[model samples]
Target: MRQERAIRTRQTILEAAAELFDEFGYEGASTTDIITRCGLTRGALYHHFPSKESIAVALVDAQSEALKAPERDLGLQSLIDLTFEYARRLQADPILRAGVRLTVEQTSFRSPGSRPYRAAEDAVYRQLQLAAQKGELLPGLDIEETTEFIVGAFTGVQLVSHVYSKRRDLLERVSAMWRLVLPGLAVPGLLLRLRVTPP
Candidate 1:
């Protein structure tokens, strides 16, 4: 029972920290803010995460695991579903929002671990490679380059939506992004079959 309570306490701290990081970037968020947000003592917060950076890393790791790619038939739909699935999560999950924000600032943090960006890139890369095998992708499109481009584009779209609309229009923005990117990536024959919106 004590162990379970400890697990819950750690989860609470992580979530409160994520919320602060989402509202304020890494530099803006402080341990005191997170502790106040969680309504937990400083000792409890430090018990789970020694520092704000540690809390940030924990959020990144947790969000990374939560971002499982949606399963789909190996084709253009697979890639489309992958993007929409993550976009859906981003719209709903504050922890993921914070994690993505941290990933965007990974270079500035200069801390250990590859973080969420690498995980997202790897997931997209796998889907792209599968599309290549199924001939769902455009001819001569390099899977690695295409994966990086799609991931980068998705990141840019999310960032723009967050900045301009506070993510209130994120779903529509992601749908639009898929519409613009798919025609170039999906095979002409498969274009009509791939739906930009959630499946």
Candidate 2:
């Protein structure tokens, strides 16, 4: 019970910090803001996170949660589902929002050797590798290069959506992104069968 309470306290502090980071960006958010937001004492906040940068790093690491999609046959569709799931989470999850925001604002937070982008790239790379094994991807397509491009493209799409409409149109934008990229990535028959939109 004590362990559970400790876990909950850590989550509470993380979430309160996320909310502040989302609203104010990394450099703008302070430990005081998080403590006040969560109604936790300075000691409690510092006990969980030594500094605001540690809180930001925790949020950045938490982005792995956003990559999770329901387990399904690993293929191009699974990869597509992953992106849609991420977009959906971005629309709803404050922690993910703050993480993405901090990832782009790396100059401000500066978590050394923190490879937030690599996590997404590795997720996409794994799916692409599976797609290759299953013959879902186009022949001669380089999985490594494709993984980088797909992750990079989705990053741009979501960032633009966040900037323009606060991600209100993120799902639509993701569908459009798949539509344009799928033709080039998947084989002809598989491309036609793939659902561009979220289920």
Candidate 3:
């Protein structure tokens, strides 16, 4: 019974921390704030999480895992749909948006050796390479360079969207990015129509 209680307590602390961190950002939030929000003592928070950085890592880990689901299918369309869906969710969810914002704004607070990001990046690279091998992508395109470009472009769009808009129409922005990028990367006459209609 005590073990179960401890697990519940830890979950509660993590949940509360996720909410607070998402709402207020990393530097904006403090340990006392989380403790107050969770109605738990600092000791309880510490017992569950060694530090704020740990909580951030946990949140990123969870998000990254969620992002990995599409890689299992190993299809180009599946990957694109999954990524777009994730961007849509991030745009809609304040907590997610805040997390992304925190990661981009506060580089020093981010985990130094985060496995989640690296794993996700590797999965994406593998998927692209596989597509190239199967002739799904254009011939002669450097798989490594293209993967890096796509990842950087997607991250840049998310950051720019967060800065310029309220994220209500992030899908539109993502679509715009796709229209511009996909045409170049895709094989001639094979660029799939973007789902996001122009506003």
Candidate 4:
């Protein structure tokens, strides 16, 4: 019973921190602010997370997991579908939007030794490598570079959409990214052939 209560308290703290961090950003947010918003004491917050950086790491891990969930099938279409769904969810959820903004826009808060981001990067690289091995991606494409390019492009698009564009047109921005990126990364001649098909 005591263990269960502790688990619940930890989850509550994480949830509250995620919300506040999303609203105020990492540098703009503090431990006291998180505890105040959670209605928990500093001791409780410290019990779960030792520092603000730890909470940020936890949030990054959670968000990475959320983004990766739909790609479990490991097919080419699955990859594309997962990316699309992840983008859609990020655009729809304010908390996720905030997290994405922090990740792409606020470079100062990004920790170089962040375990969560490294793990997420490795997982994504493995996925891309597997896809390339299966001939889903273009032959001779550099897996690591390709993965970095895709992630970087997608992140840039999300940042632009979140910061500059109206919210209602987020989907259009996502589609435009797919139109531009998919052609270049996909197997040679495939996109051109697809474009040539009779409507």
Best by lDDT: 2
Give lDDT: candidate 4, residue 163: 73
Give me the runs in candidate 4 sitting further than 4 Å from their true place.
69-74, 92-102, 105-110, 113-120, 165-168, 188-199
- Candidate 4's TM-score reads 0.75
Tell me the tens digit of each residue's lDDT in model 3 across 67-93.
Answer: 653443334554566567778778655
lDDT (CA) per prediction: 0.80, 0.87, 0.68, 0.65
Candidate 1 lDDT over 26-84, as tens digits, reads 88888999989999999888888888888887777766665466677755677677777
Off by over 4 Å in 1: 106-108, 111-115
Of 1 and 3, the candidate ranking higher by TM-score: 1
| By TM-score: ranked, best first | 2, 1, 3, 4
User: Which of the two, 2 or 4, has more lDDT?
Assistant: 2
Work out candidate 2's RMSD over C-alphas: 1.4
Worst 10 residues of 4 by lDDT: 190-199
| Candidate order by decreasing lDDT | 2, 1, 3, 4
Model 2 lowest lDDT segment of ten: 105-114
Of the pair 2 and 3, which is ahead by TM-score?
2
TM-score of each: 0.90, 0.95, 0.80, 0.75
lDDT (Cα) of model 3: 0.68
| lDDT string, candidate 2, 3-119, tens digits | 898899999999999998999988787888888999999998888888888888899899998786556674888889989988988899899999888888756668535487888
Task: Kindly report which residue stretches of model 3 are placed more than 4 angstroms away from their true locations once superposed.
Answer: 1-8, 69-74, 92-95, 107-117, 193-199
